[model samples]
Target: MKLAVIGAGAVGSSVVELASDHGHSVTAFADSSSAVIDSAGVDTAAVLDRKRTDGVVGGGAPEDALSAEYDVLVEATPTTLGDAEPGFGHIQAALERDRHAVLANKGPVAERYADVRALERESEGSVLFEATVGGAMPILSTIDDFDPSHITAVRGVLNGTANFILSRMATEGLDYEHVLAEAQDLGVAEADPTFDVDGTDAALKGVIIANVLSDDETEYTLDDAEVTGIQEISGSALELARADGRTVRLIAEVVEGSVRVGPRLVPDNAPLAVSGTRNIAQLETEHAGQLNISGRGAGGPETASAVLADIGRL
Candidate 1:
């Protein structure tokens, strides 16, 4: 497939490298850093180095790059749901041109899932976003297999950074700040880290999952959901978990019409107890019972693998 990658950050760069490795022709790479985008098809290693040096990151504007025709357009930019002009505009342009879209970015889908779905219907094109939720894990596809009416409840540790921090707090007795710094050093947390540390990241994932689990394509809102960041928790919470043979994890759940995202003390025997850095998600349904998925939650190679899988579907 001829593809266009609309970001050159960690995920986008990984997509470009993986697609190119799979023998797919990467038509254009759009990023603020012209040097990085230009070097996408040439020297990926150097492009990564330049990105590190320049810090000109996030999803690149797709205005100019989308003008060129391509079979598929992959959106891997950093998410900001409220404003979709540049990002959503690029996806719309691809669909308008009858090109398939594979999105790894959550912003467009989280804020405008209904509109984007309608656009896909009108354009007769597909928008696959397996990487958006669980990195390479196939949570979305599993939900797609069953009838929405059969789904009873959805719950899991949706944010890996929070999970990792909690896990470290339990194991090493480290405070939130220390574990967060460790996560950043390990590349699990972004430099800003607000989305992961706070519950916003998990809340967005809940919105997407709720949409998939709902019978109707009703617009899901994050307003009613209770969200709390792991930062609010003290190291003493981890100590309490140890006293009770438990560990704290940032859990998110969508049951009926209500959704909740917050840090919870999970029993030692719980599946969440086994979840490590960037891993874990579970879906419970009337028919399917309980299905669990766990893997590297955030990483270039894992996310890139998902983009490649979507490209294969095209």
Candidate 2:
């Protein structure tokens, strides 16, 4: 299959490498950073190392560099709904040309899932976004197999950075700032960790998951959901968790016609207690009860795995 990878950042680079490794033809890498399209192919490791060393992050507009038609197009950009317009444009273009789309970016699906769904329907092309919500956790496929009517609620630690910070605060009694610094140093948190720390990232994921699980005819928006960030909590909250024999987690939930995102104190026996870094999402459903899906949450390799999975489906 000929593949076009949009957004050559962390996740995009990984998808390109994985597809190339599987012997798929990676035609072009569209990013705002650099426009290096080697028709003969480029060394994945060398390109990634150069990107890291030179800080060549954030690709250029997708419209400028992405002109080739491929069997599949992978969108793997940062979690910026505003900047995702170009990626969406690329998806639309690919679909117009009757190409399949596999999205690792959350913004497009979160902000315009219904529209995109319609476009895919009109184009009669497939669109998959397994990496958006749980990363390698496979939440979409799990829900896809089950009956949506039986789903009563969905909740878990959806943001890995917030969970890592909370875990550090709870386990080591570290302050929020200290834990955040650690997360940044370890690359678990972005330099601008506002979205992850502020709960918007997880809220976006929740919106996408809700849309995927909802009846296709039902219209739902995240405007009504209450969102709260982990930045509001302090070491005092960690103390409360210790006193109550629980840990604080940034939990996003959709239950009983209401959606909420905030930090909550969960018991030590809770499935979220085992989450670390980018580890797990414990989804609660009516029929399945509680399902624990764990794996690498954020990284090129994991995201690449998801893109390849979508390709396989195609």
Candidate 3:
């Protein structure tokens, strides 16, 4: 497949870098301001290096990549809330032309899933967003394989930054501010981690899961999710939970038509209690019982792998 990748951030750059390894070629690549489009594949190495040095993918206009020839549009733009614009518009362009779209952006699917599906229903194109929920963990595909109907509920530690802060607080007997500072220094948490630590990121993933499980009878957005962050957690609270042989994690629960993400106590030995930067999704199946999928949930190549996998499925 030939891919037109938008958004020159970590995930998009990774997709451009690794696409060739997966037996796919990138015909077009773009950041916010520029793009490089070629019918015959673009030079991935030069483009990436130029981006590193110059901070732009190519000299061409970003819109050029949208109209460029490609089998699939890899929408890896940063996840935006509300209307999910630019990214949503990009996906709409691909589907309007009857071309496939594979997403690493959570905005379009998390906020406008029903609209995306409605567009897909009217076009020859199809949309797949395995990277939107869990990076490299195959959560969405697992749900699809089992048939969403067969999966009773989904819950897990979906945010790595929040998990890292919480787990470090419990293990090191540190306060929330201290652990959060360490996490930021280590690049485990972003400079502005409001979304990650405030449970918005986990809620977006939960909302995506809910949208999937609803199967079109219902449509969910972030507004529908009940969210809580780990900002107010204190050292004493961690010590208390530790004394009780339990740990707190930011758990996202999608069950019985509701999506909730908040800090919750779990047994230290439980699978949901995974530590530092690791993520786990536990699925309750109707007959097959519980299934746990765990791995690095956020990173460039880790997430790009899921994006390319979706292209393969396409």
Candidate 4:
């Protein structure tokens, strides 16, 4: 597959590495201020090195990438609310060209599902975004196997950063701030932890899942989901829950029309009790009963693995 990549962040650099590993070529890529679009092949290593040393991906502008020829456009830009723009526009440009889109960006999928589906309906290209929700875990694809009517409920430990903090507070009796700092130092959480800790990330994933299941009938957006994060969860609170063999986890759920994310208590030994940066997603189907998948949910390389899978499937 020939890919035009956007972002050039951890997810983008990892995509460059795994694309080579999977025998694909990245024809174009863009960072914040610059871009490089080539028909033959973009120098993946050079782009990555430039991003590392100079803080820019290439010499050209992002518009150059949008116009480049490629089999697929891999959109992995940072998440945003409202129109989900830049990423949304990038994907739209690709669809207009009849190029397939393998997305790692959550904004376009979560905030503008109806518009996205409309583009793919008339265009020659199709869109797939498995990496946006579960990293490499295939949560979106697995849920697609069953009929939406049969799939009654969906739930998961969706945010690894929040889960890590909550897990540490429960096990080590450490306060929220302390563990969050530790997570930041270890690169488990971003320097600005607002999105992960404040439930926006998980809620965005929930909206995506709901849209996928309903086929955009719900028109679910970021505002539709009810969100609550683990930011205020303290060590003392976990201590009280620990006395009852319970732990707090930032759980995301979609059942009926409700999409929700917040702290939930479950047994410490439960499958949902996964620790560290691991994640688990569950699907409830009337015929299939319940199916679960658990694995590492974060990290650039792991997510890029998922992006490669989507590109191959396309």
Candidate 5:
């Protein structure tokens, strides 16, 4: 597939760098302000080098890549709530042109599921977003394979930043602020760290999962989720949980048309009590009993791999 990638961030750049390895060509690439286009294929290395050195993907307007030659639009833009602008609009442009849309951005699917599906219904293209829920984890694809009806519920640690902090606190008896500072220094947590630490990122993933499981019977948005952050989780709480043979994880649970994300207690030996920056998702199934899927849940190359897998599906 020929891919047009928007957003020159880590995930976008990874997709551009790895597209050829996945048997796809990125025909156009864009950042927030600029773009590079070619009917044949964009020079991936040159474009990425320019982005590294000059801080822009190319010289053209960002919107130009939306109209460039491509079989699929890889929407890797920064995720936004509410309107989910630019990302939603980019998906709209692709579907309007009858081109497939493979998303790494969770905004459109999480916040505007019905709108995206409505557009897909009228277009010849289909939308797949395996990268949105768990980076490189194949969470959505597995759910689709099992058939959403067969899956009873989905719950686990969906945010690596929050999980790392909790894990460090529980294991080392470090305070919340200290562990968070270590995480930020280690690049596990962002400078702001609001979304990942505040449960918004995990909630967005839960909302997307809920939207998928709904199968169009219901539409889910951030407003529908009950979100609780880990900001107030002190080391003493983790100590208490540890004394009880349990650990705290920022779990996102989606079941029976509801989505909830917050810190939850899990047994120390439980699969959900994964350490460091790893992520785990437990799927309750009707026939299969329980299924555990775990791996690196966030990173550029990790997420880009998922995005490329979605493109291959398209």
Candidate 6:
């Protein structure tokens, strides 16, 4: 497949590199500042080098990559709230041109799902967002392929940073502040940890999953979800849970027309209690019983793997 990747960040650049190695052509790709366009396929190595050393991915503005030759446009930019611009716009451009759009950004699906669906209805192209919910867990794909339907609920440990922090705090009896700082130092959490700690990230993913599992008549958005982050969780709280053979994890759930992201108490042996940046997604389906999928939920290569898989499916 010919590819145009927006965002030269971790997931975007990983798409470029993996696409090249896997025999797909990356025709155009952009960073926050610029883009590199080529009809015959961009030089993935040179573009990655430029992005790493100089902080610019290409010569033109981010929008220029839209016009470059491509079949699948991978939108891997950071998700922004409210409008979800640039990423949303890039997906529109791709679909308007009858190109397939595979998104790793959750904002477009979680925030403006109806508009995105409307665009898909009008355009020749379609959108797939498996990476939006689970970094590489095949969540959407499994849901799509299920024949005997009726998914009562979907729940999981969706955010790796929050999970990592909570897991460390529980196991080591370390305070929240110490574990969060350690997570930052380990590159598990960003310098500004608000999004991960405040539950925005998990909430966004839960909303996207709910959107995916919802019917056309039932519209769901981020506004419909209730969110609670792991910011207030303390070492003492973990100790209490531990004494009872329970662990606290930031669980995201979509059930009974309600979407919620919050810290939940679960048995230590439960699938959702998988520790340290790993993710687990459980589907309560009638026929398949409880389907659980687990994998590394974050990182450049992991998400890029999901993005590339979506492109291949396209």
Per-model C-alpha lDDT, please? Answer: 0.77, 0.76, 0.94, 0.89, 0.94, 0.88
**lDDT order of candidates, best first?**
3, 5, 4, 6, 1, 2
lDDT of 4 by residue, 148-247 (tens): 7678899999888988888878888888889999999988888999999999999999999999989957699989989998888878878888899988
Ranking by TM-score: 3, 5, 6, 4, 2, 1
Could you report the Cα RMSD, in angstroms, for every candidate shown?
3.2, 2.7, 0.6, 1.2, 0.7, 1.2
State candidate 3's TM-score. Answer: 0.99
lDDT (Cα, 0-100) at 266 in candidate 1: 86
Clash number for every model?
Answer: 1, 6, 0, 0, 0, 0
Model 2 has an lDDT value of 0.76
Better of 1 and 4 by TM-score: 4
Off by over 4 Å in 5: none
Q: State the lDDT of candidate 6 residue by residue for 237-268, as single tens digits.
A: 99999999999999999898799999999999
Please give the range of 10 consecutive residues that has the lowest summed lDDT in model 6.
143-152
| Candidate 4's TM-score | 0.97
Q: For candidate 3, lDDT tens digit of each residue in 1-314?
A: 99999999999999999999999899999999999998899999999999999998888999999999999999999999999998999999999999999999999999999999999998899999999887999999999999999999999999999999999899999889998899999989899999999999999999999999997999999999999999988889888989999999999999988999999999999999999999999999999999999999999999999998899888
Please identify which of the two predictions, 5 or 6, would achieve the higher TM-score against the true structure: 5
Model 1 worst lDDT run, 10 consecutive residues: 33-42
Note the residue pairs that clash in candidate 5. none
lDDT of 6 at 228: 93
Comparing 1 and 3 on TM-score, the stronger one: 3
